[model samples]
Target chain A: MTLKIKKTDYIVITAILVWGLVGFWFNVQGAGAAEHKYATIYVQNEQVAELSLSEADSYEYSFDFGPENEHTALVEVEEGRIRMLPLEDDICPRHICSHTGWIEYTYEKIVCLPNQIMVVFNESSRGTTREDLDGVTY
Target chain B: MQPTTLKMRNRLNYLTYLAVLITFAVVIHTVEAALPLPMPVPGVRLGLANVITILALVLFGLRSGLLIAVVRSILGSLFIGGLFGFGFWLSITAGVTSCLVMGLVLVFQKRGLVSLVSVSVIGAAAHNLTQLGMASLIIANPDLLRGYYPLLLLLSIPTGLFTGITAHYLEDVTRRMIIKSGPGAGQ
Candidate 1:
């Protein structure tokens, strides 16, 4: 039997490919354009902590996270790189944040959905939070 | 044989097909979960089990296809130890939503407006976007939408095409097989 590939099928496929490539182009252009110098931690959409990632900077801090601030999260930064350690009472099943290791680029981020934690890298030292890189095509 | 007996036999035959489809879906789901994806973004997958979904929907009906999709997600998550977890919820929501979208597309497909590949592509995109939206809602992080959704959208195109092509060909093979072996063969 012959496979029936109609005109609409070609149109749909082409539309999806073009849309996808456009989104990809925007993402590529937005990322890695600035020199990331800080790692900002956000929990439940609230900015909790910001740490510098300068070569001479080194720090390890345990910050309270979660809805009630009951869970403790540790972060370590050394030599212009930063990483998030697992929680003391790690309720997160995946621990994807810790598995992500270190992120030094402006485009890289560590997100732990289970614990509602996000570590985002930014270029500016403080203020001017770069609006989380736009292009929200779904 | 009594008429009721023949009816019962037919019902059993139909149930068996659905059962086999569900089993195939579960196996593919679990195996795909275990395989490593080259993409760094989380929640991006090949969605290979969609082939079984398309097969069931095209051959059996929408209800059976939806049944397979939900059951496969539930059982597959159970096997992978992600039951009721964030990923589990993501899988369930995305799976059901995509199944419904494909079922809707199947209506147009019957009218010759689109092909199986088009149906599959639309369903795959629905699944990916739904998962991202659900994840964003669960975490209360709208930043994820602006940060990661675009990249995932870009990646879904190729992966959707891959599963769509596979489902298209498999649908053909299975149709021929059913015609040869099914009870309606003489008719």
Candidate 2:
């Protein structure tokens, strides 16, 4: 097989590699950094209830937050919205998107198993913007 | 061989193949579109129609497989009103790569089934990468992406295994049917 990769293909592969490098670099940078004033929306699985930042890590990552036991909702802050992203889809009957229903928070989430999705609000850093995370190309 | 013998050779039935591929694609798209998972990502999918891509790669060749993929994506988009905008490109890229690679493998190893499995796995991983890259660029959240790596790797392993096995079983049965029904089989 030729070692040469087309420009588009190269872009895809390199982009993935770069994504990892940048993420790694930032995680190291972000470790032990001060926590900001962002809210931590509570989600046990697919159901999302509001929680203080102090209670954020109280539940496990796989906790189900919704009435339906199908998929779990994981919270992540993105662009000032509590995006209720579904982490996995229920293999159960009537494949419902755990995200279905009302969401007041800008970044809300509803996760489904097998299809892991995490939606949360964009955590606003006190004195820093999303750009504070160095190596962040965007 | 005489010129008359050459002239009598039956040409491949391309129209029928195209029709079948398109219809199957439409049905798969309907299933994908009408149904939503418990969780929603703008572009993530099970890629169920890819099973057909594997089948085509093994039985026909790269060209037919590519044609089927393109037709499927285009028609699938029309039906769903193109909910997956960037996802369209990602799937097309993954489909093309998988079909071509699998076709080359079959040419060298004569293992169409195995090739299908590998190709599907590759497609799943590539599809994930495509979305991840876009997220990094557009969403401006590095931590959000870093958080996804473990899940992607974990999801890929089993999904790849299952999809490959399914494609393998389907290809084996379909191949037998094709052989038994083809013009020279009984004779």
Candidate 3:
């Protein structure tokens, strides 16, 4: 029997190829972070603080969801990048966020589900006119 | 042969076929789950279980294919203690969506609009999209789709093609065996 290629086959193949290409492009764009200069922290989807990555600094933030549901993360800014340092004190089950080191890309995020906290990098601090803000501001 | 006895035998055959297909699917699912992947992507898998689903759809009909998909997913989740969690919901939704898409393609196949491989690819894509939609809703992050869904779609193609080829061969062999056994063997 001869194997026949139908119109639907071509459509399916083209769709998959296009999807893969688009996904790959986004991933590449997200990983390019040389131009990013700020890291913003959010607690429960609310913006808590924004820190500049133009200089080196370190700080700690805590989220208290309830009496026994508090969580803390050590945020460090160095080498034009921001990262959450993995600490033994973290009570989260999987320390994946802490293990994700040095996120410099604008789209990169460090999320702590248990504490409902997210740290994301941005090109500039939100609602700010200047790109050179050096200190953390709420 | 008596008509009533033949009818009863045919019913028995169908029930037996369904049970066997479900068992095969569950076994394949569990085994594939145990295999290690290069990455820890949540929805990524070889999808060997779809082999049975496609076989049932091609050899029997839409209802049998849907029944096998539903039963296999539910039973697999129950066996793995994922009956009431995010994983269970994703699996059931993906399974049902893929089966329905494949069934639709099969309807079109009657008019030679698509081949088995195309049907499998569409089903696989549908499965990934359904899972991505469910995951986005659960996490309340539409960004998840933007970030990860494309990779899942790209992976589905090769996996779908492999399962489709396997199902095609298995269906042919089983069909021939049934015909050779007796006129009533496949009834």
Candidate 4:
């Protein structure tokens, strides 16, 4: 028996290809640049603090979700990049956030789902808050 | 032979075929899971078990295909101890969504509007989309759909084609086997 390819098959494949390409283009465009100048911290989807990446600093922040649920994360900014160290006092089962080492790109982020904390980088001059990074971080 | 007896035997044969297909799907799933992923992206897989599901769909019917998909996913998850968790929910949702989409495609194929490869591609894409949607909801992060969704769609093409070819061959071989073995060979 001979396998036959139909016009509809080509159409569907082309559609998927175009969609994926457009998505990839938008993703790349949204990334802006690879330069990192500031590190912003968000707790519970709200921006809590912003740190200058030019200066070396290490700090610990605690997020209290409720009376019994509290999580702490160690944020370290050094050499124009930022990293979240594994928190010894975090309640999350896996320390995946801490293991995601130094992020310097504008679109890069370190997210702690259990704590609802997100540390993301941006260009210092782009005072405009872009929601492009919202759903991109895993 | 009695008509009732022959009908009973046919039903039994189909049930046995379903059992064998389910076992084959579970084994494929387990072995695929054991293989190291080429990428670190979550929810991306070769979906090797889909080969069995598609073959069942083609050889038997929509009901048998759906039965294989549902049973294999649940039992496979149980075997892996992933039942009721994030992975289990994602797999079940994807499996059902793809099964329905593939069934619809099969309907269109009967009219000569689509082909098996197209069905597999659409099914694979549907699986990814369903999983992404479920994952985002479970993680309470709609952001999970941003960059990964497109990548998953693209990856599904190759994987779908591979499974489609495998199913095509398996379907032919199984059909020949069934013919040679006659109606109630196992009995």
Candidate 5:
């Protein structure tokens, strides 16, 4: 078994480890100290809606989605954090978006792949540039 | 043993073995999809079905491994009722890509340059990267790849290690079983 641990194998393993570490470090740093002030919703890569987040403003919003708009996603915001309400229609088979529970940080994003919907948090002072959270590399 | 007769028998044996491996892989894939992980990560899974793929590759060859990967992904998606959906596309693309990667690694393994564990690790990493890349394309969001890639890469190491070890032992057990079955068993 030890014989199988050849020089090339070690290089592959070490490269993977280093790449993963760098990505993780970048993710942590990109998510650093910035406060999220707005939650922007994008459908098919277009900004469909934007909601300013604040401790004093809490509300639930429902929007139509899907090819024929046959499905709806209900979003709940409380104390500046956002979450998706589980729908009976099951627009998404996996329900990963709803199961994501809540997003309080700029790094967290609620994405519904089936519906092509994405909800991302933006920093208070940063422009609506999506690349701010795209710094994590692998 | 007559050469032609032995060749035919070996073909029969491989066909039956392929069927069995596909069945095992399908069951594992469907069950894994049904069982949700505690973490909310979008695309992370143990990829346990890969064990059978590696097993087939080790026992049979690249062709067998690729056949199992494609057949199992399709049948498994059918079982889970996700056929032709986003998840199905993601799985098929990733599965085929990784199987090919493992097949390439098999050459080195034969030369004693790498072990089954390395083959599995490379396959797992390829699977994850391919899945992430496909997801990004389908979702039209590069951030999805950028954001969660590290976590997926990190997780693949352990998951790959577990599946690789399992595949190694499974290959041993399966070979032993074949040897014990009879002299007529395909070598």
Candidate 6:
């Protein structure tokens, strides 16, 4: 016997799939929503603003570009701060670094692919259980 | 002589078609590597060979389509295995699962036409999820899969549609010209 899948049945299935996708997308974003735990220590040329994590999972730290954007340092979580330059392109026009914003505590990504500047915020990815790299002199 | 002549020609033609399908799979695997997107994932490859697998199902049969998926995965990896790292296991599992899902539809369900568009769309859509599930098993990060699941589904929509359409067009032309024309046209 020929299986007759009605138009309505297929539509319902498609709708269910789309709804499932929408639900999953929101979950990832919400779960990924770090609490305001990441504090940015902005270092522009000679200027510096020390931002620290007052608590875990906190997110969003900001810095001023001073209308003369140059360079900055980023310390993800407990790792030592590393200086990074922003990627310049017509696409990434926002300049995530210069704008008043906050990012995660660790695995902090500074992707300037075209300019070859990629300072990632690899906070927890760095073996947290292992001794700090700074302390290991070997 | 008539029956034997037809049988030998048929076998050779089948082998030739399988060879051509493998070539297509290899080309797609290479493209997946060369065209690297800036997406956050460590390894993100399109299941383009799935087009061939779906085509095999629609044109030949479920078993043949399953064969295409298996052969392509093994041969494609042999050529471009470097980029995948440990993720090969994940892709293979998901690839097989998705193919089986569609192949089952073809084998068991008579009415649902195994169009290249439908089969690969279903196959490619599930490919990433199945692979991600495999990765989660290795990384011990089930929650990570849960987190990325939603975004992956969103991305699959347009990509799946495009790939499905391409597969559909290519298969229709090739089936019309090649498979449909071969000696076994009546049988």
Docking class of 6: incorrect
Each model's DockQ?
0.26, 0.03, 0.30, 0.39, 0.23, 0.10
TM-score winner: 4
**How far is B117's C-alpha from truth in model 1 (Å)?**
0.8
Give residue A114's error in model 5 in angstroms.
33
Checking candidate 5 for backbone clashes, the offending pairs are none
Off by over 4 Å in 2: A1-138, B1-10, B39-42, B101-116, B134-150, B184-187
Candidate 1 local lDDT, B2-117, one digit each (tens): 32565775677688788988999999999999999887777788989989998999998899989998999899999998799988999999989999999999999998899888
All candidates in order of TM-score, best leading: 4, 3, 5, 1, 6, 2
True contacts kept of each: 0.52, 0.02, 0.62, 0.58, 0.48, 0.19
**Clash count (model 2, backbone only):** 44
Q: Across residues B20-122, which tens digit of lDDT does each residue of candidate 5 receive? A: 8899999999999888898777678999999999999988898889999999989998999979988899999999999999999989988988787888888
Please provide, for model 3 over B1-187, each residue's C-alpha lDDT reduced to its tens digit, 9 standing for 90 to 100: 6447767866766777788889999988877767788976766887889989998998889899988888888888888776968888888889999999999988887689877788888788889889899988887666567668788888889888877777767877888775665436434
Write down the worst ten-residue block by lDDT for model 1 chain B: B1-10
Tens digit of lDDT per residue, candidate 6, span A16-132? 378657877667466444433322342322324444443332333334333454533333333333333332445346665434233332544444333233333323232122233
TM-score of each: 0.65, 0.50, 0.65, 0.67, 0.65, 0.58
Say which docking band candidate 2 falls in.
Answer: incorrect
| Candidate 4 fraction of reference contacts recovered | 0.58
lDDT of each: 0.82, 0.53, 0.76, 0.77, 0.83, 0.57
- Fold similarity of candidate 3's chain A to the true chain A, as a TM-score: 0.52
Models ranked on DockQ: 4, 3, 1, 5, 6, 2
Error of 1 at B115 (Å): 0.7
Report the poorest 10 consecutive residues by lDDT, candidate 3 chain A. Answer: A123-132
Stretches of candidate 6 off by over 4 Å are A1-13, A16-20, A25-138, B1-3, B38-44, B83-85, B107-116, B179-181, B184-187
Residues A1-138 of candidate 3 have per-residue lDDT tens digits of 334668888887788879788887977676554343677788778887888765445454443443464444567777557777664444667877787877765556899776667888654432222345454222
Residue A33 C-alpha lDDT in model 2: 64
Model 3, stretches more than 4 Å misplaced? A1-7, A26-138, B1-3, B182-187
Better of 5 and 6 by TM-score: 5
Name the top lDDT candidate.
5
| TM-score of chain B taken alone, every candidate | 0.92, 0.72, 0.91, 0.92, 0.92, 0.82
Model 1, residue B120: distance off in Å is 0.8
Docking class of 1: acceptable
* Cα distance off (Å), candidate 1, residue A128: 8.5
